[model samples]
Target chain A: MAAAQDTGGEAAAGKWYTAAKATYTTLIDTGHAISSAYQLVNVPSGVWIDERGRIVRPSETAAPKNQELKIGGKTINTQGDAYVAALRDWVAKGESSEFVMSDAEYRRRVKERSPREREADACFKLAVALHDRGREDEARQWWLRAQTLSPDNWNYHRQDWSFTSEAGKKWMDKFQKTTTDYYPKLELKEKP
Target chain B: MVNRRLLLFGGATALTGAPQARATVLYGDREVELTTSRVEKGDLWIPFGDLPGINEFSIKPQGACRADICIPLPKELKRKGWLNLSGFARKVKQAVVNDGALWSFGEIPTLRGGFPESRLAPDFAVKDRKGDTVRLTDFRGRKILLLTWASW
Candidate 1:
């Protein structure tokens, strides 16, 4: 969304689409009757509530849907067609579409988290709490815990890293697997 | 390892000898300041970003949790005793900045809900598709139900 906004494509694409999507998803899918995302420390997260207002979904991926982004040929970026197709599918099929998932499925998705992955969630949560309470040192410890648990999740790393300056980024570089690991490693080194 | 000790309370502050419990803290943008205490006794939940502002406002004083400390929200932190997030942020020196574009928080919500709890419903102020300021808390005392649909 920010990328879209940066290129002055917000009008063609929609400016608040990202914020709206975030809010819409939250109210429709969480234990809170409304938005409480300030506490969200991870992605693909959900809360289940029974018809009786009990939380049928806890912190888990309620919707087990995903998209495989592949780019081929001359385009420098992925096309929006898949995104648009997904939108239409969501509106046209509602929950029946393979795109739309059920609470049961979502819960199962969350349960799929391995001990290390679940521990990563806990670490992320602890880091957020510590960061919020001004315990930078303690928060860093938990964040390292999360990174050790799952090294691929970018949100945890990016959000935390954004706070520091260039100097700080350099300091964090030591812990991270370098920029190549983050982006698809384009460098295919010759046999040494 | 920090002993994996449970923080005393879920969203409340710890009282020295309380068993390790999850706690909540409102960190300042800079690490120089913190409102640390033991974790409060509740799920360290952050509301979704779109629900009526009242929802997040209500939780302002409800008690938020961190790893092992929970800091009670000050009455002044509330707008008429409800959650005033911007005010809370300001109290901690994290001045709220709109930047004429997006209103972003530098931090993520603490997870006090047991493992497998995702799908955050946080309260935030952002421009709509038309660039109008939308405050989720504005829709209070209304009998409306929310449904979420996404493209993953």
Candidate 2:
């Protein structure tokens, strides 16, 4: 999905949309469905289902060797070996094999998000609404809450950065590398 | 050779031999109605949802139809003989052409997050990259996602 900054993107999308017949679908943030199901550890994950509504492949759909990240002068994180093997196996065994998961196993393996994650989703939504309404500062507060609720989620961080200035982008880049610095950890009293 | 092998190994299954079933359909902001008998040639037709334009910042569904490929539907919908056209279509752009092969929704926008969200959030009305108005609810039973990015 298009992230809004002071600069406009709709023009670019419109021009591209008019010239091409192929449509593109983009997810803003994968809230809980993906994290719970397929146990997605990263972005751009895939789950393939057969014609029978069965997951022929469990999760980790991207080709292991396909990952390449070299932006500017820095390198992004890479997938591990386990991630690669699972994808390779799932690709070859689409339904009808031992690798094929049963309904119960699939459901169980796809971890359900806790109430915290659900709340994070709501926070992100509220942030989006506020940002769209031009209350960017207010949106950032909600986004900050979302980040606290789900530290692993990149959507909240990224959306906030989209509105930031060049300096802000640099800060975000550093934040991605180390999240604890700016958004500090909160010590809590656990319930017995 | 490796790619082909990988496709066979990685969850790619052929649907050519399977019995044709009804496909999900959606119109602008409404679910297209259908009955078992009304389905033709394994295809379910829906009305126009909205003309392609750059109004909103994000597309609804992230993986439905992207650049010439129709993301395969989950088999559960096939078994029930009906898919949530409204829910599914809300995620992508899948307008049908005369040839029967599904058309991919074109590029609209991109979000600026270093990573995507954990779940696909409900579609909302927003301005596109070019500052036009678009709504996800307009295309029920279609796949879509809102894609936006920062200029900073």
Candidate 3:
């Protein structure tokens, strides 16, 4: 998924897809709809679904390759190898995969969407609609409202700040001031 | 343009029992205007008759409903052929934002009745990099590693 503002005609996304020689379809999300739909807090998240469309594994930080990045003196946990290995295991073993989360475990891991978060979603989507109609100021207003309602949603903050001229400073300031992992640490292990 | 007017909500109610020609409804990504328009008491009153078109809700014998989920509205709310959309939304815990003539509604909470038990990876449709529409259901027969990424 190309999760960002519906701009640039997704040229960068297209270029990256070509350079990587990727075969999978890359869908563009302008309104952060996928984030809202899947209850994702940030990008590079993944959800594993079975052939029957049931979510075998809930949404979690998904990085395909191991890489450590130093940002605002914090390390983004990219559990690439273990995650990918587990994914491959699922592909090979199907429902018998030890990595596949059981329904009980899935229930425990996935949190229910709060009403405030729902409202935040509304605001975020409204911002997208206004932006589509060339109403930048109104869009910004709703985007800020969305972030305010769901402060933990880094995608809301990151996406909003990325549009401004002082994006780096804004992000660093917020990053340093806040106390939360860029991506929540996932326990990558076989389901017992 | 002579009769078209913009109605905004700012705390106080503004019900004119008026047919607001410019009133627009944005539900999710689609701005659906497939039905007649009416604004009442600072709320976008989606008439009971127009519910199916606006939000897929239909006035059934039990109540206003979509699929099997029904929200039984109060008598006062279902008046003058229009359902008190604000009241109904509040009852359903649907987030609503009225910006001038535009009203944006969030996902109706009723649809997500059961939590993890009903956790089907929602089927979503969006434009592929090639400008063609793609959907998650398109890959139903295969295992999907649905990942969200960005160039940012």
Candidate 4:
């Protein structure tokens, strides 16, 4: 399944959905509620669900195939191939899949919301609500609070920054200097 | 022109008593433009009797309660014979993000922890291109690679 964390509904997100030629269901999240519900802080995030509708894997940075970039004399590879291979293996093996995280591991990886983080989600929802009503000045203030409360969430930054003139520049600056790793290194393990 | 004419354009005031407030209230994840409210000493007050229609926090003998959850309204909140919704929210530990006029209330204090222990994904509904409501639970009994992307 595919979902857009875009707040503009069809006008902003529809073209991408069309261009992707997605065979799966593509949803438009105007309120960003889906991400909030999953406690996801960034896009290109994925969650794996099993036949019983239980989360086998929690939300994490997901890049399909491979992403190899040469920058500043360093090759940055986001092991998307390994993730995809693990996913395929899960499809083949179901519960017995070595790709599936054990209960202990799952608990370790799953984001348990902090009180402040929970408040941040609420603030985010309110910001969207204010923005929808054309009260953008108020919306910006609330969004900033949300960002401050949970600085790791790039979705909050991107959503708010899109309204500014230097969106791409702002994004690059933040991405370069922000304390959090661009993509947190996944330690997907196999049962030994 | 007509100097004596009282021009009320939406919420704006031509003849000043005090500028009419254009307050947008976000309660229980729902947003609505408050139809009736007042400002006192820079604090906005919604009438005690009008709470139900405004944001579903009705006035009860026990205090302001929504279903089982109730916050005892302090006497200060009852100043000028009106309910201080923001005051009540603050007392209850529910966040209220504001910018003078727009007051957006956060989650119910009891509902702010996180996802359930079952690890089942929280279901949500959104419209597809076909304008039909699509729910996450609809795709149950199958493996799902739920991915989120954005145009920006």
Give me the runs in candidate 2 sitting further than 4 Å from their true place.
Answer: A1-42, A52-65, A70-94, A97-108, A166-192, B1-152
True contacts kept of 1: 0.05
**TM-score, candidate 1, chain B alone:** 0.27
Clashing residue pairs, backbone N/CA/C < 3 A, model 3: B14-B42, B15-B41
Model 2 DockQ vs. reference: 0.07
Candidate 3 residue-wise lDDT, B1-152, digit = tens: 43333334322233456677766777755677634667666767765676776688898768887887777877767655667887788888899996666778888866765556787887676777767877789888898888887665
Query: Candidate 1, after superposition: displacement of residue B41 in Å?
Result: 21
TM-score per candidate, chains pooled: 0.34, 0.38, 0.89, 0.75
Residue A57 local lDDT, model 1: 29
lDDT of 3 by residue, A1-192 (tens): 344333334764667677877776777777666777788887789988889988888888899877788886788768788888999999999988888786777788887788899999888878777777888888899889999999988788877776688878877888888887877777766456
Note the chain A TM-score of all models in turn.
0.46, 0.54, 0.91, 0.93
Winner by lDDT: 3
| CA displacement after TM-score superposition, residue B17 of candidate 3 (Å) | 3.8
Instruction: List model 2 lDDT by residue over B16-125, tens digit each.
Output: 22222332222222222222212334443221132122122222243234345444555432322233332233244322211122111211112211012322333344
Candidate 1 or 2, higher TM-score? 2
TM-score of 1: 0.34
Q: Report the lDDT tens digits of candidate 2 across residue range A1-192.
A: 222322224432344444544244422221222332233333334444443333433443233343445654544443434445643464566443444455555444455455556455545545544554576777677778877887765545554565666646654465557623231111111122
For each candidate, what is the lDDT?
0.36, 0.38, 0.76, 0.75
Candidate number with the higher TM-score (3 or 4):
3
Per-residue lDDT value at A71 in model 4: 47
DockQ in order? 0.06, 0.07, 0.54, 0.41
Candidate 1 per-residue C-alpha lDDT over A1-192 given as tens digits, one digit per residue, 9 for 90 to 100: 111111112433343455556444222221111222322223333332322333322332222333333332211222234434544564465444454444454454443334455446545555655555576776677667666767665445544564455635543553243443222211111222
